[model samples]
Target: MTEVDIATKAPESDAQQDSSTNEPTDASQQMGEHEHCVTDRPTPAGQGSTGEIIKLNGVDVYISKPTDYPHTPSRLLLLLTGGTGIKSTNNQIQADIYASEGFLVLMPDLFGGEKAPGGKDTYFADNSTSLLEQVKLKAVEIAKSFMIDMWLARITEAKIMPILHKVIEAAHEEYADAIKYGEGIYAVGYCVGGRYVLLLAKGSHEAGNDEESGMVKAGPYIKAGALAHAASVTPDDFKNLQAPLSLVCVENDALFTDEVRKVGEDIMTQDNLEHEVQVYPGVPHGFAVTGQYQESAIMDAQVTAYEQMLAWVKDH
Candidate 1:
């Protein structure tokens, strides 16, 4: 597998200087001119606890624990939200749900908390938009895959990977006791977040083979990963996936079409990797996190996807 030197340390550059000079007070300040940033809004109160907002590497992440946390979580779940950004109610709901299930959920605002490039109001109010509109918007987003891929590439190289390293480092330090005895760290992401899940899995895989790889030294602690309605992922992304992975896709999702699914399946099978790819019929992209369950069929699919993710984490 060909590896990109993501961990290479270079002399301080102008971008580094800019980040230091313009420290973000809120999530919005984290966007660069060419980068897409999700807008900041009042996140709904996470169930039970509102969650603690902590800054790591100058980026803000909300950490929430189960109210009934038995002082020991089975694993730490790094929940990466889709392109809509981290503060969305949809994202909060998923985090709360995971926490309720006894997992420590850490959600970092990957877009630096800024509203995405198109505008600040691009996001629909959670549980407010009609299912029809949700489906249409998802399709539109998928149509822009080329542009989104470019944006993702730039952000991943410039910010996402480094922030990931820091988040893992922080999690180990903050939850030292729980992680020390827990099953291990795991990652779950939706849409664009899915792309990141693959990246981490690949990095973990590379690091496992080469102890000198920067990922091993940084210690992300990710034992396995799962992604749903992933976008902009190609076969190359899975080349170095070291841990077990589960991919949950919606049959009708434009971003994760049959062709994309085939590529993933073929590569993993050829490589003899431990992984599973599941596609649910008729559901659209964003079903796992944003699907309104008014329809019984959609509700069942969403429930199944979530269960699959939880099961994958446990099994691995």
Candidate 2:
């Protein structure tokens, strides 16, 4: 599609805004001027041992460097939250594992900013006013509203600005504890964040492909540079998918059935780009980082994916 076609439409609609948050929103403000640059500020806490975690607006984001190597520089991995809550035991381990691999990690708290990190249950209504409390609680409704605003803003930036800022600070914080990393950059994610890796990748690529408009918003087929190296059960962004892509789906992810995932991958493969879809046995949605994983198998898969990506990056 042409820039004229994409730009003519606004950035977001009312329901699109609702997917990320639960609040009465100013549709105009929700689609604030697109952030062209990362914010200039100190890193947020739980970041580098020396780094800080601050609120990007109201969301909690932790930007940190690897504390082990302390002297070398490294690449970055921006970890997106799983849409409903704070770090899960498995996710925390995944982030730490990446750090151990000599990469900087940015864990943005998309919901903690709203004081309602209640996961899917966050939407569960309270019933105390009477036996039948059909009315939505004012407080729950309020948090939901505010959250949507922040959520949309984060999507606009992906985790780029925060990850960049962290790398800068970590150069000082863990100057010696780093490793020589990928020359330019790449992204990996999980759950909602995994989906984000694709969206951000597409946004990254879409910016290049659809130059007239400059960037794709947080919408369908709006992702840039994501098809390649992206891990997901759903890969329907077939036709417009631009990156060298790979897909990993759980054995039992109902919404992400193996057939559907393959269909997505098949589309990419037919596009003549490198694309593959593999499903793990006994895996479930959010199962990629658990202790139950076969260490050798997982490691082999990781190496394969990373190597494939580096090679593709070299050619692309």
Candidate 3:
């Protein structure tokens, strides 16, 4: 459970879509043709008490509430998933874990109906005799697969932002008293989910339009956020961040590379934003959510990262 601050730096990761980054304005114009992709929300897995699915503004959201929910002033969090979406067993478990810690968790189906092949342990290799070999096998699996590319194409930041805003607005209305009591919203993201949290942390602003006046926009509906093994995030994202943030980085990641991290830290510092970056060594991407925890290091880092996020929430 060791914590290494971003005092030093290093590579890019697989399952990444960097260099050409988030331009939500362009995406907004192209939305009409792809409305079907963004509008088609998925149904709940009906897994009993793990969580419950409710339609929030026509989007199916998996919600995990604290036992004393509504009766207690518990903070609310939007649990953003990786490529696995909300129905994945790992995300459900994660929502429950947050609930147990006294936070009402809401996870929306960002992928609509489609989800990654594996749930939670999506990166684990099959029948690997050793942990190191398993890591290698998983690397090959990501490298050789077309799923990441397809996912990038399907889940653009522009398409998902409106859905997230709608969910936040609906959740705020549905739990008005509870949210007012606990203050406001917070967010947590894993991998692809990580990218959105960054966008959210930037808060709402005008991205401009065809008119000279431009349209005002709002979003993310979060007071703060935390991210683990974020993918496809660019330097500009960090520069634009307006809310406090905590980042959990893995030793080996192609998506959130060393250069990218350094740039992020520099920009965050220059902008005078509150942020903390911690690195967990000897692990692959997605280790925070889906690592093989039987191994001591993996388990320790996973637990430590979760604690780090919780601490950030409480501190702010």
Candidate 4:
């Protein structure tokens, strides 16, 4: 395991009005303008770290930098939170782990600043809510009405891709200096976010392969990607993937089954694209994030996944 220095700092607060937060006055007007606010922030208590939050394009991104590094970081990892949204403690733990590994980590709010659709309380339900629960909350009627695949389809079409574009642009602008020397840009997604990571890799290639679609591309910047216990990815999703991809799957996961993994693998193989699929035995869907159950096993899997992700990014 990589050693990380832990530091504490008082949170900084800054107030800035971003046009993106304003209500649109006319149809001709763009929905939102680019704006960002930086606030000194610390990692969740017990994590022993400090960083900042950047409000960009109307979304809050939690950024953490590695401490006691001998040299500047050469890579950036954009972490996408699962369905429960960015406020979950599980996400924070993963963020701290990634930051400790010496890469600049930025986590974007997947809900795009909205109150999660079905109601935040009903969705999250409890601190122990697993990745599957967040995506399929029993208390939320809407979640029950739609199947996971359909829900992911709608989310990918409506929110995930668009928000990803905004976040990428904001990261480029906000971290321009630090990114200058960075070797490459990478992404890691959990649960629903995992599907988005696949979409980004696919979309990047799609924008180049198909001109008529007019889709925004994440290809030029993101060179590698990984997904942990990802939900709702299908064979069709991998048709245009252009980057090296690694998938960390759990054997006990109900959402991403063996068949689902096969679908992605088959597609990548046919295309002769670079990809890897590692299935860890006896763990659930949110094994990498939530630490409520199967503590020892889950923790082990999380570490292995993190190491795999870092190695994949560097190798690519």
Best candidate according to TM-score: 3
How well is each residue in 36-129 modelled by candidate 1, as lDDT tens digits? 2232222233433357778864668877787866455446789988767666766777777887777778898887775443332221212454
Better of 1 and 4 by TM-score: 1
Off by over 4 Å in 4: 1-45, 68-71, 115-154, 203-221
Candidate 2: deviation at residue 135, Å? 23
TM-score of every candidate relative to the true structure: 0.69, 0.48, 0.74, 0.68
Candidate rank order under TM-score: 3, 1, 4, 2
Q: Which stretches of candidate 3 lie over 4 Å from their true place?
A: 1-49, 117-144, 207-220
Least well predicted 10-residue stretch by lDDT in candidate 3:
3-12
Note each model's CA RMSD in angstroms.
14.1, 14.3, 11.4, 14.1
Question: Which parts of model 2 have CA positions greater than 4 angstroms off?
Answer: 1-52, 55-59, 68-70, 84-89, 112-181, 203-236, 291-316
Which pairs in model 4 have colliding backbones? none
Candidate 2 accuracy as TM-score: 0.48
**What's the C-alpha lDDT at position 157 in model 1?**
34
Q: Who is ahead in lDDT, 1 or 4?
A: 1
Q: Kindly give the stretch of ten consecutive residues in candidate 1 with the minimal lDDT sum.
A: 6-15
lDDT, model 1, position 113:
71
Whole-model Cα lDDT of every candidate shown, in order: 0.63, 0.41, 0.66, 0.59
